[model samples]
Target: MTATPRPGRTIALVSEHASPLAVLGGVDAGGQNVHVAHLAAALADHGHHVTVYTRQDAPHLPPRVALRPGVDVRHVPAGPPRHIPKDQLLPHMEQFGHFLADEWRHRPPDIIHSHFWMSGIAALAAARELGLPLVHTYHALGTVKRRHQRQEDTSPPDRIALEKAVGHGCDRIIATCRDEVRELAAMGIAADRTTIVPCGVDTTVFTPHGPAAPRPPRRHRLLQIGRLVKRKGAALSITALTALPGTELLIAGGPPPHQLHQDPEVRRLRETARRTGVADRVRFTGGLPRESIPALLRSADVVLCPADYEPFGIVPLEAMGCGTPVVATATGGHLDTVADPATGRLFTPGDPAALARAVTALLADPARRAACGAAGRRRVLTRYGWDQVAAATWDVYHDVLALHPSHPSRGRSEVTPGPAR
Candidate 1:
């Protein structure tokens, strides 16, 4: 029997801090940026009209810019027209919501789905005015951040309480991983209120057949990409390198190369390399061009994502998509994405010895590493593509709309069943 096609609905994705239009690899730009960007495009590809409402962080940004066909990126003026850290963006959310309300007054959407917690707060402030059913996806929870970072956690004091309130306010919650669902349940949000939709990779961009980045011949190559935040475990990767001589590490994503020496974290990591006597073996390329990422991934002998705690990492999937074996910390989404012996290795988080051990084991056995890479590629192709992720997200929206009294699908005997995991 042929499966009936799912109908598309107008969607307003409120990602107040993480804009789909922002450049990737900055402190504020990472998975959420990629997530919103690709998800919007994929939804548009599925014939849905998408309007992404994000803060106008730059003075030159236009009010509404076309991202692609059927998609419009609407920049909402909240704080000053300049860069502001996401941690500090909360103060301007009410203003953000006011503008959102004004925009929706002119053009209301079928439903509003928010990306992160602050987006939920801003979305709720506006959604309440029109009594629109809102669906929320909290990319990371403060409780978890506090759990991992403790005193180092820079989230607002009321973040946990506000997040809980936002979760309750939303008609449905879309979690990015099973771990997130468990955390929400612990917060009194019922299991049924949340749906798990893993973040996806753009397979066309990250593939096994891409031109590999040129690197001087070395015994082995290890690459770590993403923001240079301390939690991302760049230091750990450097520390682990102390155990493997001649295996150089290439650190990507930070200020531009000319400005890299000025970056405190880069300075710290360099000092770490110097003190560990691996300074000559360590390299920093600063922020790479988007085109350079797949090549970099393809060039590495093994990719590393040793985060203190990841809430569904996009890097590992990207690495796996490129047919590179990964050595990720076994926490949060890594538990789901990397099949350990099947695709790559997962070691305990924050343990340099474990990371070294995993990398050593994978590197020492070429056959196992190649098998893992081949398996990883197959896993990404079958499961982690953007089409699968967007369809799951749309299913959650469809359910919300059908049950929502404001929607036309209400009173129907049955809406389509939820998407497969």
Candidate 2:
């Protein structure tokens, strides 16, 4: 007899702040948006029906939008239908949770997966009320942010406590890297409760074979592309530019060309370049067309990601996807992805000189850069593709579903949770 094919499960993804449809390169819109959108689409491609629930940021948005053949984007009416900074979104979690619980009560899904901490709060509540399986992925941990940003951290005061509750309450936690597992452990979560499913790159769009953007013939090019923010290390990269006289740094991402002059961070980075005496050598290419990213990545001799602290930074992976060598700080996910001296080089965070040294080394040796780029491409195809990520995530869903063979509404998960402080 032939073994019966397993039926696909319906899944709900809750992302309270990062709407899957938001344009990238915004102050708050970046990796999480990309992660949620791609994961939902990939799960749908895998024959599972998926629904992505996000805050209704615009009053004009329809209640439900068909994102793909098997995926739907549902707008949850929690707070005002306007842009609200994610750090200030915690007060709306109760309403968001109630809405989820009521919707699922009418039509339940097989799993509830949440992205970021605020979504975790809402998802945890809905899961508890409906006795549904919950999975959480904290794109960035509050403790780590506080440690790095200190007084600058804008998270709600109850963030850590609630994060703990969510970690303990959820059926499983999907961490993006090994460092996050350690961070979760420090919060009293056991390693068994968390699984690693990293943010993935779209390899088809980001391969090494694509045409590279034309560059300056005489000067070497360096690149750093993502949402232009202080913590992302644009300033550090600018500082490093002073040491490499023959190189030009391309700082891409921010408002469009006309609006770049008005952005505070852009102005700040410009001032940094000027003060470092590298203003002539630095260029700011405003938000680029998504289709042009692979070309931009290919044009760079070295991609710099010297973030103060990265929570599985996707830029390096994208750089790797384009067969570009990365020089990232050895912190957070960079430690996991950038295999030192192989795929790329790693330096200590916040050290501009060290960052410069790494970049200089990569620029000096063309063969080394090529070998690293090739290795980087191989690594991305093997480990960081969305299909692989989706399959790994599906395994987590299967394991959790197996743990709850009976209807979830009739019972809760039997796994013993670590104490939530």
Candidate 3:
């Protein structure tokens, strides 16, 4: 049986590449950042002391920064104290692990929750040394990415093997969706040890009664929001715009607003829109403020997500929360979240024609769109609230801590303690 969690218990969240403090919509910053940020805040609101340990990406950032009343962000020194692509940070896990071991020796957490595969590797090492229970959530699986991107995938060669090891070693695995459970099973993770904890939305912020953001007047509006990566299928959405004659497609998220033109993916997408003869119809609003996203979603007639594969998409839920219907590809988490012709529409992955048909149908009928949007908002309220997500996650943390009681004397060293710098 699991032990009851005490009030004020400290929980450590390890997210190596996705810092909670980073701005959203950048190449390395998206769903994972939002997930970690919101989860930490929710856990803190539950009266637990939460400390998020993330890689120190910039030299000017202090070693520690308070995120909220009960939440703190600890900058773990690993690799160069500067931004580096997530793929390149794999080789630095050993250094990250050692730093964690040193830090925990002074003040260990009751439980450690690691976010990505690399963070899992680092946390696993420290947990083993300290005899502390560890939980892991792989935001994206290497096997799935490699399968989808094939030659274009740039993940480390050993990511699959390392992930397999981490999956086996973790006390509990939190699968973001049912599809992820199947992938985990293929990698030898037992079904009994894994739990499905879907990503959530802040319904208070994303509501049906907000003033919509301003946009150019068009017969209908189609919106796509995510990183400007090839696998995200933003280009596919651009192609679909050609078929929807009067509808305008708004692509939001890439580099910062100032640096959008320099982004390689943005340039590629621009050319694609030009080639498809929809350049004038498509607008790219690069990296809008996080607070403005709900307004942006509300402004859309229909939000679209054309990802080739997604573990779990927060955007669709956000749109749904805003009472805006979504048109998403029938893959990954979309299969679980979207109810066809009810909450939103779903089409085959990578099919621009199918996407166009769904968008046109939704746009042509205002009543159906409003009905779908209402149903979607209802789904989000009852199913995908952050409070529920945090409660489920806390249950997992308690389960792990109960199974493996910590050994306080094991991690502390005989040598004199150094200054906490």
Candidate 4:
């Protein structure tokens, strides 16, 4: 039902804060970084000339770097030429937009695919100026985050409104999960313009047959891998350790390993573990390298994803790809990927007792864990492969390009103000 993808088309990917080259599992660097990195590589493999435009986060780095054979990373100057928290980058979007507009004036891509809302703002400005088609993927929704985090949510006041505007204005919106489709509809994004494309895992890297990393000398190993933010529910994962006797928990993500002692959330989790009498059993490994993650996943008796909310968690898919059973919260993307009693166990979000019960159940049965792990691997191979995700995205690009063919007179020097929808 989709048109064949034309080769040699140039595509611009705009991600303002989450650079594809940034180290994964950092405070701002998590799923989006992995998603963009793999997606760009896969797209490049498919014969498209892909350029990823991200904010320049370091002073010493060059303006551009060849990320791969056909993919280029262009660092757009905005704000201070150094690292700044993603929440603080909203104020510099105007400068970011101007930079994008200037860049497009010289050499514009055939289509602009913006990731996250801030990137959408910049891309929208340039697209309007050049009459180029725009595709958007809001990796996470501000409205949902605000609802969940409430006072703790530090998102800019205009984020929700701006996200809604971008959702409605873009030519095509890629909803990374089925749950996001309903959320998009509620925010006034048209059903026809939105497409569901779940986040994928690298099957080649995450496999069951690989040599697993060495584990601590404990009866069982339970793993929790993600940022140490409160919303990620690392505390709950530590709490669950109290119920699973003879099992040691390995918390593998936060700031870099050397900087772990300074992270307040890590300190809080350590305190929580002490209070729960599991301090001796919980080990903090800090952040692991991407290359070491697959081995770590394979070493786990079970991988825990006890997040308060997740847009589309790549961790569950990665664990599944590694043939490791996941015990995840039953919310957001986890609902779509985690098959209850088949691939993994899911519990109500924020329930420490429920999380404990789920993990305890899995830890007690090796046969069930093996069965679930095998099923998960099969599910990932068939559905969540990066090749499949990139092919689907390519089809989307073809369709969007076909519908909105570029015109010779479209790129006239008209500096139109960005759309607020």
lDDT of each: 0.87, 0.88, 0.88, 0.88
Flag clash pairs in model 3: none
- Candidate 1 structure quality by residue, lDDT tens digits, 295-414: 999999999999999998999999999999999998898999999789999999889999999999989998998999999999999999999888788788778777786642232111
lDDT per residue, candidate 4, 1-421, as tens digits?
5456678889999999999998888889999999999999998888889999999999988999999999999999898999998888887787898898898889889889999999998888778767788889999999889989999988887788788777766778998988899898888776898988888999999999899989767479999898888899989988888888899989998888899899999999999999999999999888888999999999999999999999989999999999999999998999999999999999999998999898888988999999999999999999999989988888788777878746633422222233222
RMSD of 4: 2.8
TM-score winner between 1 and 4, please give it. Answer: 4
Best by TM-score: 4
lDDT of 2 at 207: 91
lDDT string, candidate 3, 1-421, tens digits = 3234467989999999999888888888999999999999998888899999999999988999999999999999888999999988887787888899999989999889999999998888888887778889999999999999999888888788788888877788999999999999998888998999999999999999978988777468899998888889999999999898988889999887789889999999999999989999888999888998999999999999999999899999999999999999998899888889799999999899999999989999999999999999999999899988988898888777766645633322222111112
* Candidate 1 local lDDT, residue 234: 95
List the candidates' TM-scores in order.
Answer: 0.95, 0.95, 0.95, 0.96
List the lowest-lDDT window of 10 residues for candidate 3: 412-421
Which stretches of candidate 3 lie above 4 Å from their native place?
1-5, 405-421
Superposed Cα deviation of residue 24, candidate 4 (Å)? 1.3
Backbone clash numbers for all candidates listed: 0, 0, 0, 0
Of 1 and 4, the candidate ahead on lDDT is: 4
Instruction: Quote the positional error of residue 243 for candidate 3 in Å.
Output: 1.0
By TM-score, how accurate is candidate 4?
0.96
